[model samples]
Target: MSSVCVNQALTDDELRWVLTRLDSDKDKEVFGLVCKRWLHLQSTDRKKLAARAGPHMLRRLASRFTQIVELDLSQSISRSFYPGVTDSDLVVIAEGFKCLRVLNLHNCKGITDTGLASIGRCLSLLQFLDVSYCRKLSDKGLSAVAEGCHDLRTLHLAGCRFITDETLKSLAERCRTLEALGLQGCTNITDSGLAELVKGCRKIKTLDINKCSNVGDAGVSVVAEACASSLKTLKLLDCYKVGNESISSLAQFCKNLETLIIGGCRDISDESIILLADSCKDSLKNLRMDWCLNISDSSLSCILNQCKNLEALDVGCCEEVTDIAFQDLGSDNVLGLKVLKVSNCPKITVTGIGKLLEKCISLEYLDVRSLPHVTQVRCSEAGLEFPKSCKVNFSGSLTEPDVLL
Candidate 1:
């Protein structure tokens, strides 16, 4: 199901030319067949070229393959990807990738309501569409998709910032089969929008509202009351208006929750977060309380003691935690943890992080950047070794940006 081949045959300069030459589109077939190693590049490398490298490059990349089931031009793209981008751009992307099952155009700054209308044309086969972080996208764009993409299941418009209750209402009523919906950072959404969503999409499994500041207990209560049983993952990060009461209601109602992220809610107490984590310990796989200033060592310790299934934790900026908090979470218990990021926490030293390295044998990613000990930990003299597959970035707190966590 997976394969990785290193491009060792070409020098760095040669590889650069091959990728640059890929823009011409005509060289793609021969580019794909240049060697057996080049085949893997087709799947993984195409997106990189589309995002960080060049948007026009995707046209050449898209031309190489006969079938493109998914296309993600999400957070990474800095510009447009169409030959003649307009309000009609979404239609263009839709039509070109005719067989597209998934389309992601998050943060495409140039995209607007008109371009979004073009996306309705893609509705037949498009099941997943993420237009989040796109400041220009509005209800007109969403309405087109809702009316046309009858088969859509997941729609993420988080941070579109302009969408109101009308858009949410249309989506809920029209896309009855919708499952995962992320309306995070939509400043204008309120109880009206949320009520419509809850009433319409009873089957929604994941709801992400990381920073929709306007949503209050009224908006959240609808989800707690209606979508509680079916909810699997919920993200309420930085939603300052949502207090502990709302969080508690969510925990009590959404018993089947698997992943919960409530980072940056300053008003919510550490006690509430701890209670939620402890309550969902068995099923909670990923929990991020980053920048939750109220969460101290006591609450985090509670999480460690109760949440044995936790695999990824972000306790960044929790100044109260010390080495004692990690004492209970030795490597023996967290064998499945792949990412351990605790950047910017003051209490932990690189030496404290050694406890994790000593225990979590399957650890592949360790990021302790901005911790005080990044400069202190000796890479050569730790008497420890990283796995051949593991990657760790320890930016220093010192002038060198070195530290460990």
Candidate 2:
């Protein structure tokens, strides 16, 4: 025991092996703190990072995590005072991490077209980019990305008000492999842009035009027709211009649609919704028709009867939906339903919701808030009858502990 003394240190590869075994980021950080060599190795091996975005912080990150593939520089509401990541910071990011694939600058108000252009010029391998709520970003910035990142797959430009049809045209011309595109709150984007987009980018699978007020049936119909086989998730929430024609087109052509959110699309009638339920019954899982004033028992009954695989159903604010819709619910109907939201339905009482709970044994979430006929006392009484795992929202406000379960 006194004769043998092993002074050999673990090799870099061995240290990396150990680093890979660590599950938590805290454990990895502790490993890095063991020595400068370990820190360097950890930094080099790091492929993803989420940190506060600033010129100095980004520069340091770029220098340390040269191999980073995913970078989240999303600004939180609490940190609004700090000046966010800017064009110069992006330049540093582009130069440092050439292989960067996913970049999320969500809510980074300081990021403008110049910063995005820098990313486009350098990060050609970039695939998924989320610039959601970056109000300063216009078509000019995104067009540069479309031209450069040919393999771009998922791009979320939600709340980028300045983004117009020009960006769509650019994307259609260049990013043919684009699959998921989020144009939510891009009010400037209309049917013309969508038509042009689907013409070239027919591989698009998930499209979210939620709150794109100008987008109507013409644009959505084009998307349904062009990406009919590929389209899976279509969210048109608050797209007032979207009517029965769009839903009909989707039901007719896009048979594989999985998640369809027509919430706030008042123009959607029971006929179109029933058609949608009938057409996409097999594939449709999550269906949301919140604020679709015309949807009644007919549409609800049709959905419950047809969409057996339905997991999440939200008919909130649907003025016409009543207890009659739940009358025919059987043990087979919506068996897999996990989330049921019938909030603000003036006609739906606790009885209707209770009937739904009985049928939806797998129900995990039940939102019965704002039901004029259903009081908190009734909800509390009904809460005991709900599924064991179910969480009920009796009151409209989430903060109200008395009415929530």
Candidate 3:
């Protein structure tokens, strides 16, 4: 047979099979450059897209990527030159993409309740949505989503200050399948709201209420009790109202808790930490207690001794934690500690950090910044002793300091 006839015999499905086997997006792009038919097939096969979103851009995207399931219109930093996605763009998205499952509108400041209402009415299959930092969103918008998107499993409304108890009530009533929720910086959500939410959403696994000042022990304790078996990751960073009471409740109920972040919770004392370490010894893998003023060597020692599977620990700014805490790292079970951050700890000296470097063979990241006794010269001299794969941060720099001649 002739070469032209053999090439013409290849069907669309065969071309698509070849496209799927391409190693990278670059290779696929090169394949698409062959002809207009290949380009159209690549566009139709695309399932995920991340690009700058505006009314015209979204229109173009909806026409090109007909089967897009995940659309990311998130902007890390908003620019004045590029207009943010607004309600009209969302209307276009809802009308065009009927099967959209994951929609990320992070930092889309122009979005409002009207835009979300459109999404709720159209995108019933939406399972994941992130509206973090969308200051204009309120309960009215999220309530619409809850009423429509019943299958929602993940929702992040971090920095949406207008969200209140009404939104949680709506979610509890409809979105009972919610597994992960991030309400960080939602200042208006108080204990009553959290209590209402956890009463129904008992299957929640990951919850982040970081900087929710109105949330205290009452709210967190309710979550710990209600979602005891399911809750795994909990972040209470900067929740000054939280104290040992919440920690005690978590220790008693949430045995599966894996990651706990209580940074800036000054009220957490050694007693509760020790109890928590003992109770969650087998499950706890990551613990961040930075700026917890009451944590001392006693609790630090208890954590190192108990949490055999601990992979990451951050006790930065715990003034009372001294070099004695690092002594426990020598244990065989504790050698698996991978990431340790003791930055700004005045009592931790070169001796303590050196001990950690020598003991933690699998350590990948070590942050010793702002330690008074860990000077650049000392770090330079001891740099060779650190794990070959580990990255050390000293005085805000990760590079190894040059030793003086």
Candidate 4:
């Protein structure tokens, strides 16, 4: 019986296919150094490139990967490096990578509106642009983008505090295909601007106005009502002025809403939660109300009873939540419940969490940190172990229970 050869040389296409399966960029880059042929193939096939190696490195990358589609300079230290890519570096990129679709310049503090204008002039095909935390950019730069990148779909202007209604109005008029907009921490934005944007861009699906304190119920309501049927994910974290009225409007109109995050909206209460659960019950998947001090057991009970498809729930720092909230949650109705974060709820005990776990069989992540009575040892002593699928986070300075004499 003849056996296949143990060491057969692979064709170039087969070799490239194997290399393409590598998950990390560093691993793939290492493979590129193996031989000139491998290096050429790797460079040609590379579509996404992340840089923190400064402007010179970016120029080198642009020369190598001519067909690059996405470039991220988030300065996140993916390779334990610093990002020195300034407006000059962006000019180099904008000049070279015209085919770019997604460009993330997160935390690139050196980039100014001048650089953004350059990007707007170039990269017409760009769809997703994230300049979050680029402090120097103002409405002037954003208007440039609106004028140039008419096809832009997803824009992240988070931390660009200088931007206001003008930018939103420009985006609304030009980028009609706009779908996702992230305005997190843009404190200057008010209701009028957001309302203008939503009215024109009714197709928007995801809107993150997290920490936009100036935006109140009147402005957000316009968005909820305009894009009601089309909106899917809405984040209003730390938007203090938003109250039950805006939430009710959202619940009533955004019938297709899937993810709703209103964390730190202190004014919101059970009325908002119940309205949301009742309106988007079937479609709701993730709901986060962290730091919402007014929420209680009644709200959780309402969610469990109505939003059967809910998977992720975070009611952390809600001091009012207690064991009573978990008692009815374990019913067969919420079988899909997987992640539950009740951390900082001082009133919850082991018994309550145990009851909750018993019902939420699908739960994989359980954060019960700061609870008084739910120590790891106590859990073990009680003959209760988080199943292989569950990971329970514990807090508090209490030592494990003392062994019996």
Q: After superposition, how far is residue 159 of candidate 1 from its true place, in Å?
A: 3.7
Which ten residues in a row are the worst by lDDT in model 4? 396-405
Model 2 lDDT tens row, 1-405: 455422146777888998999999999999888778889999999999998756777778888888999988888878666547888888888888897999988888888999989988999999999998888889899998998899999999999999999999999999999999999889999999999998789999999998999999999999999999999999998899999999999999999999988888999999898899999999988888888899899989989988888888888888888899998876555478888888888898878877876788898888888887787687677774778887777775553221111
**Cα RMSD to native, each candidate?**
9.4, 3.1, 4.0, 6.0
The per-model lDDT (C-alpha) reads: 0.71, 0.87, 0.89, 0.84
| Best-to-worst ranking by lDDT | 3, 2, 4, 1
- Cα deviation at 22, candidate 3, in Å, is 1.3
lDDT tens digits by residue: candidate 4, 117-225: 8999998999999988788899999999999999999999888989999999999889999999999989989999998897679899999898999988998899988
How much is 141 displaced in model 1, in angstroms? 2.6
Candidate 2: C-alpha lDDT: 0.87
Q: Write the per-residue lDDT of candidate 3 for residues 112-150, one digit (tens) a residue.
A: 999999999999999999999888999999999998999
In order of appearance, the predictions have TM-scores of 0.71, 0.93, 0.93, 0.86
Of 2 and 3, the candidate ranking higher by lDDT: 3
In candidate 2, how many clashes are counted?
Answer: 0
lDDT per residue as tens, model 1, 74-105: 65543445322335445546656666778877
Candidate 3 residues lying further than 4 Å off, grouped into runs, are: 78-83, 328-334, 379-384, 399-405
